[model samples]
Target: MSRFPLFAMAVLGLGLVFLYVPTLLVIATSFNESRLAGVWTGFSLRWYGELLNDRQFLNATANSLIVAGLSATAATALGTCAGLVLARHGRFRGRVLFLGLLATPLVLPEVIIGLSMLLVFVAAEQTLGWPAGRGIGTIVVAHATLAMTYIAYIVQARLTGLSRECEEAASDLGASPLRVLTAITLPMIAPAMGAGWLLAFVLSLDDLVIASFTSGPQSTTLPMVIFSAVRLGVSPKINALASVLVVMSAVCLGLAAWLQARRGGKVLPE
Candidate 1:
């Protein structure tokens, strides 16, 4: 401890406090006896019970889970394909343009993405007379689009650091392109794929802005419900919901760390 610089230690302490203090407060408030958030009369579990019984909340949670699960799967598939193509297919036509398009969503504002998606959906409805209206399907599509960018980047980074010897060896043995991908490339990047899928799931579950724009009356997600509750005022119910979300986020983070560590172990020479 004494070997560390004082300024660095102070900054680290401040940063930890900045990040976790509010989270700690929210968790604590969820157990409070009072109905209001941040006002603790005593300890209580009433809010958690109430949360379990709230029909709207439960519906929103179900919708969010469905969207997150389906969207994450879709994003992982699309992103993994994108990453594989970019990593393995050397110097294709419009490679730079394709990569740039893939990366655009990562840096683009959520508002812009949401608005553009909304317009596209509206146009499709008007022109094709399909989709009927925005709902779970639209939300899933929007989230998948947002999540795929992150997945593509992660898979790309993983592939970049990977040795291509296995793939080359397989090709030399007369394995077809599809066989090499399925048998060698995918197995090599399995950890990265798992990480990317979890990342996509978490991102989709936590989204508010894009869901707000793309979701319709039938498809209110958990974040939207939480946001509405906050506008009215923070209650113990909100605190409880937030606490559950925190637990979920922590689990996802732990799983990601485990996957990364496992990948590192496999990649390192013994």
Candidate 2:
């Protein structure tokens, strides 16, 4: 173990530096008072103040949050059910097909998914005459579809680590299947469900391609706005926005961990 300790430590440190240095740099740049993002005149929250007052950015952020929340909720609900079925139900009919459908979105390129959604929406409007125009609802659905598979994968993996004994015991004690599901199964898998919801929320929030395809006029998301701003040039405000997102993501992960530690007591091994 001591033979190559220095080398192993060097490699680990190098990898962490490579992964985190850029993020650290971005966070530092966000506080730069200069109009240019890369230049650091002095530490200041000037850009953040500006960002807070920017109506367009705030609106886009609001849109992103709304879409992300709704999509994550929908994905969590659907994905939990799919995960339950795949993990618990044995040799169900069309299981292979169901898995194929779930896996397709995960493997498909984002551009393809976005374009396909666009085509489907256009076709639907042409035929069903519903969804008169693309907006938050369409974006929510697209994001949900894109994120659902990921949540299902997480939930299914978590379920695999769990023993079915509690559920079996509940059923043996005269609990109905529905009761077993609601009282025992769901609570036991609550940590995985929470983790899945966070994943879905982050996935939907960070998405650019799929959201762009489904978004209509006045439905721009934060990513879209950031991309457009980047096209012009990376400004201090954009850096501030990135920093805000970074902080938000960190807070979310911390919260999820805390919740898992609290709610996952004895259900699965730590």
Candidate 3:
């Protein structure tokens, strides 16, 4: 029994190392002076400097930020509403089927989602003569479709843990449902919403497959740029860019964690 416990711990440790050690190595190599990724010739920030000055990279970053922010906000709003209806109002006619449809994107292959969205855009352009062509709008819609599922899941979980007493109290005090929701309910679930927003943001920003299928030349996101660059060959610049992204993600996620902790250990409010 003791040997089995030791083996389990060993396996867990190995798993962690396998997952993270390479990432740490890549981060360390980003600072390496040598162009060859395998070699380290002292530490230098030259690659980082180069990345900062690269206009294409900067433009892609800006585009990514805009897309992530807009898509996440839209997704969070839609998901929050859906979650409220599902959790608080309970099951209604066709609700289960609707929820299953909503959740389909979460499990369906991303490539399929991307292709479907692309086909729809093409069809719309051909038939309705709208959208003009695919670009930022298309990407945003695709991202929002996927990201909303995450937000809905988070908000639904939050709603499940919430106490209805607060809203009841507000109603007893002559506050309307809208007023209670705008004031008490919104505040109570704000943490979960914030977390869901951040999660959506990350998902949108990191997405490559869906973006590739849906995006136009003018709307190429950071991941798309990275993918294109990598297709040519490995470059230290790519590593540098990846390190920057990893750092940004870490900082954003850390901030979200701190805020969540400060609000209370619970992901949802009561």
For model 2, the superposed segments whose C-alpha errors exceed 4 Å read 1-8, 261-270
- Please give the TM-score that candidate 3 achieves against the real structure: 0.94
Query: In order, what lDDT does every prediction score?
Result: 0.87, 0.84, 0.87
> Per-residue lDDT for 41-97 in model 1, tens only?
998898899999999999999999999999999999998998788777799899899
Reference-based TM-score of each model: 0.93, 0.91, 0.94
- Residue pair clashes in candidate 3: none
Candidate 2 local accuracy as lDDT? 0.84
Candidate 3: where is the Cα deviation over 4 Å?
264-270
Which candidate comes out best when scored by TM-score? 3
Per-residue accuracy of model 2 over 1-270 as CA lDDT, tens digit each: 786998999999999999999998989988888887656689899989999899999999899999989999999999988888877789978989998998888889999999999899999999999689999999998988877787777677678778888989999999999999899888878887887788778878889989999899979999999999999987778889988888877776676666556645221212
Poorly placed runs, candidate 1 (over 4 Å)? 1-4, 36-39, 265-270
lDDT of 3: 0.87
Tens digit per residue, CA lDDT, model 3, 156-234 = 8777777899999999999998999999998998988898888788889999999999988799899998999999998
lDDT of 2 at 155: 73
